[model samples]
Target chain A: MYKGIAASRGIGIGSICRIIEHDLTFEARQITDTAAEKQRFREAVEAFVQETTAMAADIRKRIGPKEAEILEGHIVMIMDPSMSGEMEKMIDAGQCAETALTAVCDMFYGMFSSMNDDMMRQRASDIADVKVSVLKKLLGIEDVDISKVAPGTVLVCRDLTPSMTSQIVGGNVAGIITEIGGKTSHSAILARALEIPAVLSVPGIVDAVKDKDTAVIDGTEGEVYINPEGDILARFVLKREEFIRKQAELNSFIGKETLTADGQKVELFCNIGTPKDARKALECDGEGIGLFRSEFLFMDNTRLPSEDEQYEAYREAAQIMGGKTVIIRTLDIGGDKDIPYLKMQKEDNPFLGYRAVRYCLGNPDIYKTQLKAILRASAHGHVKIMIPLVTTVDEVRGVKSLVEELKKELDAEGKAYDKNIQVGCMIETASASLIADLLAKEADFFSIGTNDLTQYTMSVDRGNPNVAYLYSAFQPAVLRSIKNIIECANKAHIPVGMCGEAAADPLMIPLLMAFGLDEYSVNPVLVLTARCIISKWTRAEACELSDRILAMDTEAEIVAALKIAAKE
Target chain B: MVSKKMTIKNEQGMHMRPASLLSQKATAFTCSVKINYSGNSYDCKSIMFLMAACIKCGSDIELVCDGPDEEKALNDISEFIESGMGD
Candidate 1:
């Protein structure tokens, strides 16, 4: 067994088919490179370009356009006149098909590798992708489908491109182990969306697993087994069955009310970043929309989205829920995610640096545009807008001021908005959670953003691999922070809830309930498990547990107590 | 070459981003634009050269343009800079 960054979540067993690797530097056969040979190579390259363009279109048809955009970017590079000029030069230099192809790919790869542009870096992946396709075509293996490998097969390769992975039909895949990529790469993103059990960045996968040998893979843990012992196989079978059963249970909760065993009703909302997620929210029986990250409105396009464009999207979301609560988070883009137009500098520490509401406050046009859109769409359904990364009372006042200013603009312009729309803030930073009482007095509500609160309280970045485990919302400091926000809201007569990754944890649900979390929002898939956890405990029982956990001082004691409580 | 000396007030310095923002706006004019920092000048249109200047947060830089719209360009850019990149 080995550990890897878990890209997708699941467990499976399969026979290993050590896939053919394409990582070798191209060793082109020599060519006479006469005028005829040059002409032939250019024609072949053009053909490849045309075919890839068509393939990109097909990719769009198969996957959603967002996923397919990764390929469409490549088509632009392939058609670049400068790139074609480079290839023409290579063909004139008397290089053979293989040699010319290698030279062109290497030159393009070098240029892109040195590029600071993220989009160009992503485009480079396309060059590599097409180069692989051209090579497969050259070898006469382009027609052989990977589905021929049979069921229950684990495909192992030195590396697999996004196109290569996507070509492998879903549902037939048992597991996938690769020599390259982390969670952020394109292929990994596709794999994750498909929910295939996968492990990437594994070292020496080729040397250990023999072809045709049975292997059991745990995608959740990034573990692989080769010719496992009987005991291990027994455990794998049980684990696999348990995973399936758990998924079935989560699926069973489709359109069901989220009622806990003790009948304490907690709103289970879906944390989404896209309009398409509204469908998933409805499918999961999400009672309200907890977090609708509006950054997508700013990203993936030139200039900010128009008010009507934003209204159309927001209205679509509101219409989908049939009057369900849709709590939209105003543009939270910052840190690693930034717009070139925003004129932001690289900070030594991005997560803790100026971002979110600060960026909005600095660029009032952007915020006001968003506020106008949200206000305009409020008539569509139960819409609530929340400000992110608030750390000061002044920031809360600023948001209120914007809402008022926007309202005044709307009223003068005769634009309609729900006059009674609720405004709220996310207690993401240590400063915000600490002074929750004062901010709560200003805002109508609060949602403890555990992702950042855990990071700030423990000085551990949840995204940082080195200390991600230490950044636990269940940790005493983090729990205390949540308790403080809830306690403050309770004092100020405002409601507080949690809408972070921790909100979905069954083990933490009891602890959260004890702390008086009024609402819980999680991933769409985890609605039932969280609901089940909430149902098992009463308000009084939860209040008691909250008091005890708040009184505890050490992380160890908190974890131990939660573990014992989970068992009970 | 015409120029306006200015300081970056947006917490971040007069570095790459403000330079880029200023540069992007300047290119809309039918004039050539440049920025000078600490006596070294750079082409305002080049994001690379501007970023390479290594302007830290809360630092100062100068903006210059040589074209028919240089004055208006400088004035608008100066407001963008003065307003801490604007809200």
Candidate 2:
């Protein structure tokens, strides 16, 4: 067996199977000409329609109306002009029921494929479902397991559907090779989830391999070697075993505080999106939520959420944290995030234009509504509200005024809230970093949002694919900004935290720790690594390393020196 | 024929996840279930139609069922929609 990039983890040993390119073409559809066939077709169509209706009803019962809007595409296909017209045309052409449905599905899929919006891409699946359903009826075949083929099966197809991908469970017969699919494809997702090794979009994959040839799959690296020699197989097997052991070792440390050779303590926190993520954070032994993106509340909605509703959501998260700190970033929407109901005008350059506290300043009504919710929720447990992308000190003062306004309203109504609640600002952009000392005086705390900080410092647009690689937290300017902000915060004796991906990287942990970061909030997965790094160094050693880094002219030398100086 | 009535409840009323669940469950049955609100009636499996009706958390609607498990389907479907999606 040969070694390749493992797109996913886990081992699968199986004989190679014949590769087949999946043709999505739907033919031999039955539109039904004869009276008997028409009758059957009508019954099937009606059943399909009713089935779709009941499903929508169930969805309405769970996620709510705003989210259920996605289902309208499928509903439109089944009921109105989309599917109905296709079926009628096929019937008029005197085609069979399956043939007619297939023709209609082709037309619908074509219409959706041309649309610009990505959310509409799933509309193609609707037509595919209709074609698949009609074909299933005609062939008299029950559901086929797309996740795993029959025993001794090493099936290779062009691409897998979402439903089929979800069906894939661990311990499959063997390796999978496909010609079509990308990093985000359904087959790729399944491979990642099942931890089965598979290679995707491997051009000329079919010609090189054949049935009954033993193959090795490395889904993690997206590598598949056909008919490998003994030496190669032995090497891969050893590597796979080592990876599995390391993974298990990481899991065993979950919920345990990390401490390295030395004993200097540093708080390790996790970044979160929803209350559900709180569970994962707890599992990773996070001290508390370091950066909670709270903008999800307003993302896909026609109306603003009520204070009580927001309170319950915040309370749920607080209860999950079990009284651990939860720093909730308030109204981070601006720039890329736009809510129509909030009446945010479109800008030519959204990133450099209005966003964060800028939008909140203009729309204090909406800002106060969220403030009320956060203040009300504070009664449940430790909850801190953080404002995003703050530059000038005036913005922080303005934020305080609004908080006071809400506090007065809550006070008159006799509503209970944490009286001395803390307020913080995300030091993300260059302007914010430069004035961290001044802003630190106004705000209770500061958290470094390195995702934006790095982009801004390097003069690269993070969203632009070509420039994205240039945006690195390891850059000297980025580290300088972090150093400047930390130094400023230290001058005021206020705690400073880093909550971006850089804060979570084990390789970068020593860098931030060297900058005298009091707290590190990262993806829950990185908290252990950060804690381990922090515990090993003395405050004095870190300061020297930090000074060396600040004086460096180039980023490369600083990184190399950091590696040598940091405790292993 | 079987019929039942209830108010829509789950907080994010008639949204994506709930609609998919309703549609998936509906596909399992051979019967027809239609929900009526105001003067309009929509197929229960049509997530869009249900969502188009814009039934809020407190809105009342009638669940009408006809077919193989009319009574049983009516009871189960009614309880599901009325009990606010899932407990």
Candidate 3:
């Protein structure tokens, strides 16, 4: 069995078809006629453009225009004067067409590959793809057309280039395995767009499997089996059916209101990092933006983001959410997430010191810039301020006072904003849970950050291997803390939400529902799945189960009881 | 020749989308369009050059245009940059 990064969900059992790397090796020779050599290179480029244009149109029709833009970007990049003009210069100076193309491409590949940015590094791969395609066109090489592949063919390749992925006929290819790429790579993105199961970054995968070999890929588990024994195959076949059935069941919940079996309605939202992800939240049917992490505005910039720049980012998210609640967390910097420009001193216990609301309160000017941005954005939609890692009631009061001051400034400047904008605290620390009732009184709302809540409640550093066993949210202490936080918010008559991995856990959903969680904020992809889980039990039913589980003293006991009570 | 200095207003700076748009816009002019950033001049008509320049948000850059329609080119490109390059 081979393990790989699970790029897409589902199980795929099919016959393998390996796309071997092409041999574009050519000899560099002096060209007698520079004009003819340049013409040859130009013709290859023109042919590449024509073919790519057709493929882009097909992808735009089948998958989406956004995916097609990758191919279109190839067109723009290849035609750039810095690219083609340099190649023309080499060709004019007596280099062969192939040599000239390779030289220019190699120069760009080096420049992009050596960059520190991930996006620029991705461009390096893109340039490699373009070079191969144009080189193949020049060499008169014919590719094994993916469109012509038989149904149920599992394509194994070194990597799926954008042009290669564009040729994939829907429903013909069952799965894809590649030696390179991760969840965010182009190959993975294309596979998800095509609704095909894929396992990527499997070392030696192409060399391991032969053509026509029967392969079973559990993309959800990132596991692969070649020529699997009878029992294993049967088990996977059953699992595949079950996955498909569950997917169909989840699809039925899309465009429908999130409700419990006994008719208790709740909001299903998404936790996003960037403003652009708001569109994905809408696409996934998320009702609102529950936790819009504002750190991206600072992290992605070399220096502090201007108030207007931050406002634009927040406003873009607000506009995309279309008046839905967008709870923007103030810059949660310092600790493990340090911005060099901020000049944070190194600390022994970074996570416990100078983080989130603590750091924001220390740097009043930076905090005000972010607060002002969120305030300006509230005019466009239902924007709220959320303070992260709150350990004291004073943190909430500090942020609220800052918001009030910023509101007056905006009012004086004739800038519009939501007057009733909410300022909330994230109940992540043990102290926050202990004073949840007090914090709830001062704050407009509460969001339980279960990941850190569990870490702090159990005193288990998630990064420390020795105490990793105590990091589960299913721990009795963590569960009690969560229940108390939600109850405090309920008593204060303010809405409470969970914006952590636990929110999407099927086993924890009932417990959260029983605790009267008003919102469930999960990764955008899990919106429908979470809604499906939420709809399984009524408040009374969840509360009844919770009563029995809450009596358990051990984490294992609690987990076992919840698993037996799991609705899905 | 005509030139104007301004800060890049787009949050993501000169990424692929904005760079492509800027290049396409610059290619439409009859004048030569260039952006001078950190003592380096980049052709505004080339997406590669623009991206390679890495003119991030908050970074100040000078837009220079020269030729038959230098004034119009400078004004048009400057306005586009001012509008955050349609980010």
For each of the candidates, the C-alpha root-mean-square deviation to the true structure, in angstroms, is: 9.7, 8.7, 3.1
Model 2: DockQ vs. true structure: 0.08
Compute the lDDT of residue B44 as modeled in candidate 3: 95
**lDDT tens readout by residue for model 3, A1-568:** 9999999999999999999998889989999899988888999999999999999999999999889988999999999988998889988899998998899899988988898876787888889999999999999999989999999999999999988899899888989999998898888899998888999999999999899999999999999999999999999999999999998999899899999999989999999999989999999999999999998878876789899888989999999999799999888887678888988989999988988888889989999998998999999999999999999988888888989999999999999999999898899999999999999999999999999899889988888898899899999899999999999999999999999999999999999999999999999999998999998899999999999989999999999999988988
- What tier of docking accuracy does candidate 1 attain? incorrect
User: Which ten residues in a row are the worst by lDDT in model 1 chain A?
Assistant: A73-82
The regions of model 3 sitting more than 4 angstroms off are A2-5, A21-41, A93-96, A202-209, A343-355, A358-363, A391-398, B1-13, B35-41, B53-72
lDDT for A177 in candidate 2 is: 71
**Predicted structure 2: lDDT:** 0.70
lDDT of 1 by residue, A536-568 (tens): 778777677767877888877887887777722
- Error in Å for residue A113 of model 3: 2.9
Clashing pairs in 1: A260-A535, A261-A535, A261-A536, A262-A535, A362-B87, A363-B87, A364-B87, A365-B87, B13-B57, B13-B58
Per-residue lDDT, model 1, residue A41, is 58
| Model 2 CAPRI rating | incorrect
The full ranking of all candidates by DockQ, starting with the best, is 3, 2, 1
Q: Candidate 2 on A1-568: residue-level lDDT in tens?
A: 3343345555555676564433434466443345666666677766655655664454455433432343444555455433555565566677776666676677657765565533334445545755665455444445555445555455555555443443444455456677666665445555665556677777766777777777777666666777788987787788778767766666665666655335656778899987668887986789999888877667644567667656766877888898899998988886778877878778998888889889888888888888888898888889888999888999999998888888899999999888888998999989999889889999999999998899778989878898887788878888888889988888899889989988866557766666768788988767666665566666666666677777888767877887777564
DockQ of 1: 0.04
Q: Which candidate do you rate higher for DockQ, 1 or 3? A: 3
The TM-score measured for candidate 3 stands at 0.90
